[model samples]
Target: MKLLSLLVAVALGERTLRPRGRNWVLGVGEQGPAARPPARLPAPTLSAPAVSAFADPAGALLAGLRRLLRGDPTPRCEMSRFVPLPAPASWARSLSPEASCPRALDGEWLMVSVSGRDLSLSSLLRKPAELQPEPVLITMATAVLTVLTHTPAPRIRLGQDAVLDLSFAYAPPTPEPAASLAPGPPPFGLEWRRQHLGKGHLLLAATPGLHGQVPAAQEGAVAFATWDDEPWGPWTGNGTFWLPAVRPFQEGTYLATVHLPYLQGQVALQLTVHKPPDVSLTPAPLVWATPGEAPPELLCLVSHFYPPEGLEVEWELQGGPEDGFQKATGEKWLSALHHHSDGSVSLSAHFRAAPVTTKHHGARYACRVRHQSLPTSGRRASVTVEVAGLSGPSLEDGVGLFLSAFLLLGLIRVLSGLVTDCDPQEKVTASTPPTF
Candidate 1:
């Protein structure tokens, strides 16, 4: 009795077991579709299972059972292609069951022709119907770039250290019809190109941030610097590059290109280099001296500028017009300017002018600075020589001294006359004559 129960349990377990599209048996053994041998003589032929029948599990099981009871029919799978839209009329008309389809392109039409002996369209339609292709599936790919800087215009001072940052990021390609399906990471690279400035116009240094890689910088010419990123599958991340410094060049607009893998993408970067002049005005003696003394010198200092070849300095009496302003000439305005090794300039101007009076007081002697780097208004520095007050005796003190001097002279003369006349008037009869 126990053995009988064990056999029944085994049977139940076998019946419950189900495998994916594989052959099975009930209380017996079964052969897979691939392992069956062909029949040599005439025999009863069974109908094959329809591909569409798989959509209904119960119906597929019933059909599979019926086919197994009789002689099994050969199963076959077939694929068909439809010509994409915009194709020639002949091409569309020529589509056949054996024709192969090319890979579908984005924004292009594609036809999927599905048919097989096992999958009966007529049965599903409940009547004979024409075959048609389904909608096309398009795949989209993109690459995005962003630039960040420490300065407003990403400006770099000539011969001075500066750094610019660039960030490159991208996402994986998305397959249409099934947007959730993302492609595995594709290989990517980076190349830098210059548009405006010629090579060697300025020295440039490139360094990649963490997660950034450059595989071919030296292989390419000076105009292009190449980089490659380590593969990170279908994930969104970014890399950065830094431009530490640049040598002096003509002040103008410059364009840098980033050769990206994006289709129909515009990826060019821009920067500006300016050499605005820094000016200062000074007088040898900041204040005016007495009229008898020699005139003081006016000095102007121009510093921290670039491309000094065409630099010019003009002197103005206050804020005067350019025509009214005098350009620094010969010895009157001596320039001790020299171009520095670092592509910068430093210079001084000297001018001699008379002492400041009330007319010239508070009037600004301006040094207008001009250069190719400066804007239309230009840059300027000014100095004004002020009048100095006299430090001497006042009118009240002079009058007191004169009066004392005159009084001393008169007393001395009177004393001298009295001493000389004393002996001649020595007669004693003066007192008796007075009494009579």
Candidate 2:
């Protein structure tokens, strides 16, 4: 194996190693009625599975032909050519993983010509009923490719370290005597850009082996670091880049462009940093509003979350005194909001008003907050309804009543005693004043 690898590498003139489709549709192709495979004993068969992975039915149909054909098969059909065609300009960043990007894609046509026996079209079946396969799957072809899914691409995630792999399907362009990015000629470059990020001193010379260094910092043959794109940094014609420690500022559209010695195109991915809400829940245990006058309210506070999308607040009712919570409906009040001086915003959802019946003795109304950050059940807080039944007044009310009665009785007694003492003694008061 090592000898074989070495020989292959030497044949390709590689100092060391080399290496590495969705919207995925498949179509089957059949030859015209006039076309037919010549019965010259047997011929080499093409492997249909090798050309496309999704052509499973074509693979099964070709397998039967391979078994019947005894001896070395002569090659009949060959894969002409396939190229990675870029999406139309109007599609823009259509391939971006962001949900906002339109998923509708313009179709690309694939022309297939098969040389094999053609069966007469079934006249009984209508045009709509006739079979129409996708992506040109060939069943009776003599030569075909044993198709398999290609090497997996990079898994992009925000705030996580991952390899930004830019591998070529074909053997890369011939290695020059010049320096490479790594042991082999793998591309090593990292660039981040957005207007809000402001400017940094990041620079990359057009020459190879620059590796994210400022143009001024590099040595001989810097070539003055000329490029049209202003935000470029640390990139050359390498096959891969080690993207490390993704930060919040890096959240935005990330476009990976390739300008090889002979080719140029771009692909993009989206990165959005999600700030999970602080989710402070304040459950008011008492009735949320004045009894018999206003609607009862169950309030939920969702605070400090990023990308302030709309959230859902649900109120659940306890089925019975001892029963678990179930879905309860109420007229939704407007959401309450809280804002911080630092510019953080939070919203509160209130479940108030709307009554079906007032028999809510010890019934619990739970307020559940559903946001992009929370789980399926969401962040919840519950409050039990203390139905205003035959209970006495509160302690403060009872004490106030006692104090008012005592003060009133004392004032009445003092006024009556003064009035009773002054009336009959008025006649004796005049003679006593003259003697004095």
Candidate 3:
């Protein structure tokens, strides 16, 4: 218990002293390194000009005019410095103005360069200095732009409507060096340039303006670009802009590019439009079986489909004692259907009976297919079930029957010979028989 109390006391002490040590660490308190004395700036010298009342009055007037002209205290001119930022994926920096406009971070920040000359007269009072202008350059103001584009591919069906999305938000420039003082880069604007969506196979309906008002006529290119004249350095704020709804009539890849005219920076994205699958059902062949054999399972083929490439096939049986042959629901009756390499699916239903009886002899088996293309009545195909087996004597049984009949006829003939002609040679002696 004593050790625990001691640990608690130590923790409290640390907590209490931690705040006071911050000043020492920052070099602000006496506990820290001694602070360096501030540098001394030269003081401007002022002395009454020597003016003799008897001197030339005209010279005094000229001197007074000169002093009044320089009285505004040389205007401070500072040079503006621009730091080349890392180029974005689409924009390039350090290019000649004619080559391409430099790009700023999308909705993030824009650094501006300013050039000015400092005209402080304090130097004139200290010593005779060269009459050259002092120019200072610095990156003073930063403009921020927010860029947003449709994520992923804007996927749609060939005939479906797709809206291309590209938008940006421009935040007010950072307050630094008075807004009126900093001369930033030329106004930056974003506009849609071109589309490679086939040869007019895709049609665009309208190009919307900044106020969500569409233009009078449909345009091939859409621009969200607008100029800002607030002297805030040509940065315009556009909340959101949508590309005209486009209907793709072809199935292929398409691309669109949005550009920042001032920076020559562009953002491009690719869109994919797919064709709906063509679905078809093949006629299921008739199922046949023997009297005591299992019926062959029936198959209905759904072919020529794409994109999804697979479909569901159902089996419905009709014509049994209950006025309908109920489809088998057990797992044993159905086989899992898989798509072929060629993107075709074939599903089959197995029909079985412990001992196939005549009750299921004429049942009709139909396969109903389900796919995007085929509608209600057109997806079904039926095949009749037939039980046919040959009923005829076997070769071994026929041979045995023929042999038995022949043996019986032979026996009858032998018996008749013994009864009527037993003694061909002694048959003529009728009197001898009588005497015996």
Clashes (N, CA, C under 3 Å) per candidate: 3, 30, 20
Better of 1 and 3 by TM-score: 1
Question: Model 3 shows how many backbone clashes?
Answer: 20
| Model 2 spans with C-alpha error above 4 angstroms | 1-208, 211-252, 258-260, 263-267, 280-285, 288-298, 319-330, 336-345, 354-359, 388-436
Question: For model 1, how does the per-residue alpha-carbon lDDT over 141-162 read when each residue is reduced to its tens digit?
Answer: 1212222111213456674443
Best by TM-score: 2
Misplaced by over 4 Å in model 1 are 1-153, 159-161, 165-185, 195-197, 200-239, 249-266, 275-278, 285-294, 307-314, 318-337, 352-358, 361-364, 370-380, 386-436
Model 3 poorest ten-residue lDDT run: 1-10
Quantify all predictions' global Cα lDDT against the true fold. 0.38, 0.36, 0.36
Give a tens-digit lDDT track for model 2, residues 169-269. 11222223324323343232222222235443221223334433323321111122122221221112223334455444544543443332222333333
User: Which rank order by TM-score, best down to worst?
Assistant: 2, 1, 3
In model 3, the runs with Cα more than 4 Å from the true position are 1-143, 172-257, 261-270, 275-436
Q: lDDT of candidate 3 vs native?
A: 0.36
Error of 2 at 400 (Å): 7.6
Model 2 clashing-pair count: 30
